[model samples]
Target: MINPPALTLRRRSEELFNSAERERPHKEDSAALLLFYAVECGLKSIYMLRNNLRSTDDERANAQSARSFSHNIVNLMIALNISRVSIRPAPPIVIARSGLSGHPLVLHEAWRYGEKVKDANTIYDWLASLIDWCRKNR
Candidate 1:
């Protein structure tokens, strides 16, 4: 099971993304939301995959891959919102310790944008794109 801090970050990130999606415009907002969602999914996938690995396999191998993937995903999310502020602290240590930094949705947003982009153009577009992505992905 994921820890409270990590889980809270995920839920908060999802909520922020959802809020952005509903109130914002389209395109960029959707992309931002989708990017976060993808990262979140990728993080979860890596965790499940790692847990299923053979006991004889090196856990570090799976951890490394998951870490790299998560880092990239977080970077993408940051790029999507250059003006946001982070609600959480550095890289969200809880998730990173679990090799799930790629899924630090809340950390990225809170650290980057948080509630700062309440009336930004990019946020609007990101929200719209998020809705479309959610429909297709779902």
Candidate 2:
């Protein structure tokens, strides 16, 4: 049987996060990239499920509403109609960028290059936790 896109995305997100958490050499960048993807996909998956969407195609067909929010985590949470307090770990988007102090997760595409995140462990932990919570709630 085919799994739903939400499940698929969450699963992949978990897999990548696990790999990133291992901290292997030369893998940090890719891991970070995937980790961000994991969160993005996880959020989208939940959003799609809540919006009565089933497949990626379903999301694509509604691209304006579904695909558009894939990049920014802050927007995804808002589009999901989720309040800041409702989300655990208080996603980076909700955190003050000044506090993050150059953390890539706060900046657009900064996390793509693990070096920019500064505290990858914290970001990873937060993202992993967020994905877990979002997936469970969805």
Candidate 3:
């Protein structure tokens, strides 16, 4: 498990929030992005568990628990921010497809403004770029 620097997390979060504000015109998009960001943070917490847990079993359990908790958090955030619409379960594929490999924090921004992103590339290319950026910046 790798511990991303605190500065990186703060910068990533700020960037995501700023980007979401700029690109998210629809309420649903904004909600989705917010939810995605919460999930990303939750995942980070789970990732951190790997460093402290003693056994693989504990690590796996922690990861699953963190994901469940994050899902709930996302739902709550969505409900709070965007009223009048029931939160829908987004498939993992859809969430994963949104170029979230690196800087998981970017998932929020992407969720909100991914459609506006004009960089045309295969999913692999997009993911690769994100991973590279994470490595360089981290």
Candidate 4:
């Protein structure tokens, strides 16, 4: 039986982030959604690597009931015990909107629903920093 490595998610996240970067000039809204997924996958990779959940079997066997692998990047970051001070800071709007699950920095729900993200470039840089952090930590 072949099992997938935890780093697979990191690779996919990087691909998505890079694609988003290329699309940013022509399609900012699309890029925003891609950034959300990139952040989500990066955070998950961090969780999987940290917990040794390398395969589905490993995850099933060792998964903690309290931890969730959801699209909420904030919760995933919390689960991974990431230090906020280590990464670049999010813009003021993102910080103020952090509590909302639908916020662009949190998830893709806002972009999917056709809502425009304010300070999107700042958010993009923050997410890119997060992906970089994941790469370093993983």
lDDT of 2 by residue, 1-138 (tens): 333566787677777667766753566546656767777777878887777676655654544445656477767766776665555554243223334453333544654433344555556566666676675676
Off by over 4 Å in 3: 1-3, 26-31, 38-138
TM-score of 3: 0.28
* Alpha-carbon TM-score of each model against the true structure: 0.28, 0.64, 0.28, 0.77
Model 4 C-alpha lDDT per residue in residues 67-102, reported as the tens digit of each score: 255566777777777788978886644322343423
| Clash total of candidate 2 | 0
- The candidate scoring highest on TM-score is 4
Query: How does model 4 fare in lDDT?
Result: 0.70
Please write out the lDDT profile of model 1 over residues 1-138, one tens digit for every residue.
Answer: 232222343444456556545543554434454445544543333343434422212245334323333435445334233233322222222322233333334444532442322223433344334333333332
Give candidate 4 misplaced runs (Cα > 4 Å).
1-5, 56-67, 92-106
* Native-structure RMSD, model 2: 5.5
lDDT scores in order = 0.38, 0.61, 0.38, 0.70
Model 1 TM-score is 0.28
Give the local distance difference test score of model 1.
0.38
Angstrom error of the Cα, residue 18, model 4: value is 1.1
lDDT of 3: 0.38
Colliding pairs, model 2: none
